[model samples]
Target: MHPIPRIGPTEAADRPRWSVIVPVHDCAPFLADALTGVLEQLAEDDCEVVVLDDDSTDDPARVVEQVGRDRVRFVVNPGRLGASATFNRGLELARGDLVHLLHGDDMVLPGFYSTMAAALDSTAALAAICRVEDVDIDSAPLYRTRSYRRGTGVWTDALDALAVSNRVRAPGIVVRRSGYELVGGFRTDLPHAADWDMWTRLAAHGRVAFVDEVLARYRRHPGSDTRARVLTGANVRERVAAIGVLAGYLEPRRRPWVTRRALVYATVFAARTSLSLARSGERRAAGVQLAEAARCLVQVPGGPPRISR
Candidate 1:
């Protein structure tokens, strides 16, 4: 285990060791529950929850007030600053040595705080990520796991290996404050998949520990931005862009494998988009996706790759 660096003044009698940032935007229906889950997971001695209300019109302030203003600091943005910017703002105000980003719709599992902290202490990795279980709008379990291996050794190899699969779920990961700043935090350009992009960048600098146990519940619903991006065909482009960025960071010999994976994933994404459009009775859009898929197949070296189940 590597030595974990402590931050802030030891002289300050009461300071949080970890800062959990929750970026909220009109998530009133689930905001209270999400905040409750976060607060409930932490012992009073471990962390502080900073809720950034990104100009929510749903009266989220009331929920924050109900939760109490002492432990949870509410920062109201002047206008709707989007998720990336809002989260960055919260990171700026964070006082803890480590940081955990929790979405407004997600819930932390029991022992989440203690488990992640222990992982950090034991592995001395830059980030500690646990498995996340997909959940429904009503918070019912969906019985699926998203997990990744602990990244060790050379930073580049760890990053390349993790890049081979998009298994890192954003909410399940906790990062050291210094490491987060080193990566320049999350990029605001890729709004939908910014977390994916950030993870790829973080892997370039230090090791990442992946715990097999599920420590968070990731809610999925019709209104989920993830679902919206996938259904609207935006995720395909974002993923392709992410692959391109990662390819530049990998060695020459590894580029082909990475490119191949990207092509295969892109093909499947196009197929799914076409199916979604067809279901909506938009034959024109479906035809466009089919044409795009055909072009991708032609560019791929050995012809169209078989879509994975």
Candidate 2:
């Protein structure tokens, strides 16, 4: 392993470029490729890659060390600090003008940094986001791309769209350091939905630029965080919370549409949870989920009673 660069706070500020922060936890198998994707674009003088290993039980630290520490700064957490805490920590440690929160399982496509940096330079927005391609565990395409390009970049409508659906995947966003600090980074309370909450708050205060090209790859696996959120039904609660948050930002007429979508998503999530639990022979859990679904249905007047398959 090469010698790790002794990066001081001043040294990072002097670079005045992008800093890629990746929070790794039990993802040693994919960390190599993720780091490679980031380091390859750095141009030596432009950016630095920081990997915060949150007490990963896997051999991620060893691999990072073997890959050389000159371009990458590998920090090992004393204990497992969950994703939200890890991301916040990375933000605190980042020494760049801009921060890109790349997950350990995701990768940056070729020319990603240059393209986004140029976009940021041209615009006066606090952050810029690009379209993201969804890939399976084996890196195969998942048939649909996710993005946030509607509504002519209006903040209020963007907030509503985000509250209704998580079109802004975390990996696709590159936020300015000052803007990230202003929004207080990710919320530590909501472990599973902090990213959703953060983005909602981000759009409320500043302009967000959207690049239609797919510059990042978001990897989805059965054991991935997204999958866990879906299977455990945490996504429903997250979306509901997002709706409540957006109420403070959206117009009255738009509020109804946001509420309607929340209820619809909640109902569908409950049904999915019930069915999954039933298939696993957890009848009692399934019943509980069904009751929750019934409660959500009652909240919306004139709402459809049936949950779509």
Candidate 3:
């Protein structure tokens, strides 16, 4: 573990240790729960909440006002900005050492801030991530969890881990504000895979710490951008483009290996989308996804690996 740098008193007074920025758009139903969850964990004066309404049509301001604007600062965007831009706006407004961008529909579990903050403070890592529980619209558990590795510790093989898959879930991840600036914020272009691209870029800078516990809940509903894009088969191209960005950061010798892994990842992704569509009774969409998966397999250097149940 690397020693944490000591901060001067002047710096300490200017910035809070954690800035919880919730970006929302038409997520009124879940916004209250999200804010409540965050409010419960904020015990110290060194943390603050900033809710950015991304030109939401559904009165997100009412939700934040209900949560008490005195405790939570709220900002309504005059014009529409996408998720990445909205988050960037929040980042610009944040006055904290560690920046945490939580989706308005997602809720953080108890001890999320403390655990992640401690891990980050104890290590030289640029970011820290933990497991996330997948939940339904009503906050009911879906019995699924997302985590990058088994157990808890720092991840040294950041690039290879990302090459295998996006181990870091954005909602459960806490990043150093300086590190975010170093990476130049999230890419507005790679909308679907912007988080993946950001994670890879951060990993390139330093190690990423991991917490074993499920510190947050990611809502998995038809309304989410991810689910909607996946169902429509639009995320496939965005994902490939994201991998292209990842490839740019790699050494020439390692690019081929990573590219092969990326091809396999894309194939598996399409396969999953196809299976999901089949289960939803969308036969034509399922067939299209299958065809897309087959097309992606053609780019694999060693051909596609046989997938078994």
Candidate 4:
């Protein structure tokens, strides 16, 4: 199989400069909110919305029909294409200069469009990202990520920062279609952490504009992919692998410190999450997390942080 999800060359039409692609998989309950957020802000002539399903059991098509039937296009994969391919299909189908892969369960806040558009336009950035808030299933805000900058500006340290951390989530980010084409598609191998890998690729290629204000809400629930991976410790394991994939993108001298720093963060995070899960009586999941922590520790420089059983 190819190392990355392939997005072939295609003719570019000169209309609808914005494409809001919502990739769904059994996220019927929250699909409406996502469609609504984009529809409310879009200039109909300049934007198109596509809801692509990864062959989910849930009839999300029905939900899409009720949400914005007139304005949205819906497509379903013949079989599950996983996150990377599902997203690559969105990019392929997009006839827009800017593409936003707003996950079905996520929603953009008011002014999300105007602010992000202006940021990219003024800065000529390859991509633009804003602070994202984590929310519950009910759409109640839990917490927001730290500001990447004091205000809206171009990020100079994006590549370096992304190598050691993945603070930016998909909903809060928009990529220029041209830059994405140059960078290639998401890595199919890193199923759970492919977005992080793609972000590192983007940062490596060009500038990333940042908006300090929180402009998107990322739903964190049991049904979400990250949460599902957490149960089996696949999230941490994939992240460790993703972090390792980033080494090739950095300077030779910087690679060692970046890899070590990222591995330490992953190991500590897994170990701490394991203890928390264990205290909450999730023994099976906790054990899985602890094992992953051990695996990460093997690659981390220096000794592991102290952790109690």
Candidate 5:
């Protein structure tokens, strides 16, 4: 990757503080609300919203115009670049010191930018994240996520936090542009866990600050990639692949521990996916998942018990 040109304080001051990149794909129904939420929090010329339409069949550009023609700059991709590539395009076009990539279906709360930006600024961390609440298709609150709420402070040991679980939500994360310049964009290869992978990489560079309050709403619907992938048993595979990739980034001595943890996590996750598939009336797929889980257990470094699923 080529080095990004260093910008002086004067040049940065001339640009927006926040470059909110909203990537939309067939999310016309939710675009208006998402844009509204972000537009309301924007501070005059200090923030710019870049709404990129990833060749959505539902004409997301119409929704963007209806919501805020003056507030947002809508760009329609000539061809579908998928999520990671589209987001990387936004990163290239971003002119702000801080970047926030918000999914079109997810809406930020009233004080999300203010709170998260403050956290990053005060802590001088590379990235800041707030607690995210899961919402139904209708945008009604389901439950608040406590993944990043271990405590409200700057976490310098981000690897430790992420090793347990992906505590940061994509919508809730606000990262410095310098971090992206250093770590590069999200991996197009890890579709399901690209965001998790990016966060882990950024964490390796600097601290990640967390806020205690819920600042964003993550819409959980059947159409979402995570839910759809999980239903098809692809989520398990992608998750394991992500764990393997992240394990490679660990220190030599720490790699062994992370590798074992990855296997254990993958095994447990496969079992859970199996149960979910069975509950969803996919008995055959569930059986396949169980077999995979058993295979994962058998593949552990040392031979253990011959556990049958």
Candidate 6:
């Protein structure tokens, strides 16, 4: 069982070790839980909470004022930046060695900060990720993401792990600021798959630590990108674009093989999802997903292998 951290306000240094940046836009309904989660796990001095308000119609700053108790730094975007750009804006404002882009609608589990911090410090990894519990809008657990590793340490096959899809949610992952400096901010074009693209780049270029424990809570609501994007098949198409980004990060010799495998996996997953959606009577959305699956399958460097369940 994870230990609950004692809540304490922080006046972290000008350059703290960790920055928990919460990007908020119309997420004030859940912002208090998000801020309280971070504030509770904040280290005595080396962690800072940065609430980036992306021209939110709701009062995210007020939420920070209450839950963060004026401890979290609140920054308002000059204009309305989309989710990807808003995250980049937060990245620009973060003043720390490690950056965790924790969305304002999501909350972390207890022991999240200390556990991930220790793993990154001990392993010298470019990033660290823990399993996440997927919860409903009411904060009840629906399911937990699968763990890639049993023990806490470097995940050697991290790139291949993310080759097809992104299992890493924002809350469950903390990346080195240096990694961000190297790869730059999230891709603006692939809004649905930008985080996946960024994660693949980080995993390709440097080692990533995996903590078997579930240290974050990811809220799965109807408004989330995954659900909203799937209706238009943007999820599958943007996934292909993200795979292209991943290929660009790899050596020429590894690109074709890795990308082919990724494409095949994507095609298979999309196909399966299409079938499931069709069975559930979402014919139009299913057709879109199926068309994307066919397009993805044809792009496989070599013809896709006969994949069976």
Best by lDDT: 4
Q: Write the per-residue lDDT of candidate 5 for residues 1-309, one digit (tens) a residue.
A: 222232222255578898999998888899888999988888768988999989999978778778886788999888998997788888877889899999999999998988888888788998988889989998888988775446668876677557535777679899898888877887877766778888888787788898888889998886666766655667766766777677656777887666666677678888988998899898987887787787777655555445599
Q: What is the TM-score of each candidate against the true structure?
A: 0.83, 0.82, 0.90, 0.93, 0.89, 0.91
Q: Give lDDT for model 3.
A: 0.80
RMSD in angstroms, candidate 3?
A: 5.1
| C-alpha local distance difference test of each model | 0.72, 0.74, 0.80, 0.88, 0.79, 0.84
- CA RMSD of all predictions: 5.5, 6.4, 5.1, 2.6, 3.6, 6.6
RMSD of 6: 6.6
Task: Output the worst ten-in-a-row residue range by lDDT, candidate 2.
Answer: 1-10
Angstrom error at residue 111, model 4: 0.4
What is the per-residue lDDT of model 4 for residues 2-89, given as tens digits with 9 covering 90 to 100? 4765666556756578989999988898999999999999988989899999988888888888988589999988899888889988
Residue 297's lDDT within candidate 1 is 58
User: With candidate 5 superimposed using the best TM-score fit, by how many Å does residue 192's alpha carbon deviate from the native?
Assistant: 2.2
- The sequence of per-residue lDDT tens digits that candidate 3 reaches over residues 1-309 is 112122222245668888899999888899988999888888558887999998888988888888854788889887998887787788887878888999999989889988998888778789998888888877888855555567777877778768656776668899988887676677777766778877888888887898889889988786666766665667776666667678877778988788889878888889988998899899888887787788778877777766799
Residue 238 error, candidate 2, Å: 3.5
Model 5, which residues run further than 4 Å from truth? 1-13, 147-150, 303-309
lDDT of 1 by residue, 244-280 (tens): 6667656788788777766776777687788888999
Candidate 2 to truth, TM: 0.82
Give candidate 4's TM-score: 0.93
Clashes of each: 0, 0, 0, 0, 0, 0
